[model samples]
Target: MMMVIVSYDVKTSDPDGAKRLRHIAKICQNYGVRVQNSVFECLVDTANLELLKEKLLDQIDETKDSLYFFNIGKKYHHKIEKFGSKDVIDLDGPIIF
Candidate 1:
């Protein structure tokens, strides 16, 4: 699996824009963890990444909104540096319920 950093900005001056923003966040939640207000860290294969991109694209308006995807590849542990309160999750590690 590859790590993908997804970020977006939605024009939220109106109700439609606000709705779209929420929809976008919901979509991202299904695929990964939210690291910030509008940023997500997703670990997915090529096909799943494509699918996520498609879903995000569909929720955004080309003229008013913007979306970005940064593929961090398989070796991502060293590339990221975090100095904050929330601890980062190991996407490749076992899930503890």
Candidate 2:
């Protein structure tokens, strides 16, 4: 799977910027992604990477700019997953509300 690391520095750090980002993120959900700290780590087929790029571009206007995609997998290969007590789920079946 191709992992896409996208970073963008917005001209407007207002809600507009965040809104656009969230919109794009919604589209990216079609593939597979984990958005953290303004970086979208997308796991997808190598062939679909371009498709993901296109979707991101569609969300952005001609105004934003450092918008870069760093293809990682060869560079860094390790990342940790953290959990919290309140976020834990039972291994059995249904979850209590």
Candidate 3:
């Protein structure tokens, strides 16, 4: 599996825009862990990654919303560093609840 970071900015000024934003966020949750309100960190194989991208693309409006996928590869652990009070989420560990 490869580590991927998905971030998005959806225009939510109207009701339709808000619904789309929520739908996009829901889709991200199925494929990865949500680290922020509009960002997710996912570890998936290439095939699944492609599928995730397709799903996200279909939900977003190209003219009004933006999505970004950062392919951090398999060495994400070493490449990522954190500061401040955010607890690092263990994506590969068992969920306790």
Candidate 4:
């Protein structure tokens, strides 16, 4: 499968920038994308990556902000490595004393 990682870096203040970022992230998520911080990563098996790029570009326009995205071109060799990583805390386990 083909995996994509897009690191977005836009020049704007925290609040406005973050708001736009969140809006774009939502668009990506709506397209079945897996996001991490400003990075949007997802795995798919297709002859090309056009669909993915299109979704991201739409997000850029949706937020009325500039954005950057590209395919990291890393392949998911196996299922054990996991698909994507995020900043979420591990809520499945118990806390230690």
Candidate 5:
């Protein structure tokens, strides 16, 4: 699987904008983990990545919102650096309830 960093900026001045923001977040959550308020770290294959992109694009308003996807490839462990209080989740590790 490849690592994908997804980020978005949604126009939240109205009710619809807020709804859209939630919808976008929900979609991302289905595919990965949220590292920040509007950033997510997703580990998926090429086909799933394309599907994620399409879903995100459909939720965004092109004129008012913006979305980004940074493909970090398979060798992504050393590419990322984090210095914060929140613990990072290993995408390749086992999941526990």
Candidate 6:
């Protein structure tokens, strides 16, 4: 598995723009854990990563938005650390709503 960091900047000033931004966030949520409003940390295989990139590209308007993917390799665990109020979430855990 590879650790992929996905970030995006989308410009919007109208209702359509708001919808677009929500769509982008939804797409990222399908593939990773959101670490920030516009950042996600994804753990996926190479093929899935490629697919994710394609899907992201298809949704973004290049003329007004930007997307970035950083493949930090499989050894990313060794380099990761956290501090402050943020706590890691276990995605596999049961959810109560």
lDDT of 3 by residue, 1-97 (tens): 8899999999999898999999999999999888888999998999999999999999999999999999999888899787877677888888786
lDDT tens digits by residue: candidate 2, 61-97: 6576436787765333454243554332222237355
| Candidate No. with top TM-score | 5
Per-residue alpha-carbon lDDT of model 5 for 1-97, expressed as tens digits?
Answer: 9999999999999999999999999999999999999999999999999999999999999999999999999999999999989899999999897
Could you give candidate 4's per-residue lDDT for residues 1-97 as a string of tens digits? 5565556655456677676667667766644345555665555545445676676565553444665555544543332234455443222235354
- Candidates 2 and 3 compared by TM-score, better number: 3
Best by lDDT: 5
Worst 10 residues of 4 by lDDT: 86-95
Candidate 2 — which residues are off by over 4 angstroms? Answer: 11-18, 74-97
Runs in model 5 deviating more than 4 A are none
lDDT of model 1 at position 21:
100
Question: What digit string (tens of lDDT, one per residue) describes model 6 on residues 1-97?
Answer: 8888899998887777677789889989988899888999888899999999998888888988899998998888767676778777644456454
Candidate-wise lDDT, in order? 0.95, 0.61, 0.92, 0.53, 0.97, 0.85
Q: Name the regions of candidate 4 deviating beyond 4 angstroms.
A: 14-18, 31-35, 46-48, 61-74, 78-97
- Between candidates 1 and 2, which one is better according to lDDT? 1
Q: What is the lDDT of residue 51 in candidate 5?
A: 97
Candidate 5 Cα RMSD (Å): 0.5
Question: Candidate 4: lDDT over CA atoms?
Answer: 0.53
Show the colliding residue pairs in model 1: none
**TM-scores across all candidates?**
0.95, 0.57, 0.94, 0.47, 0.98, 0.86
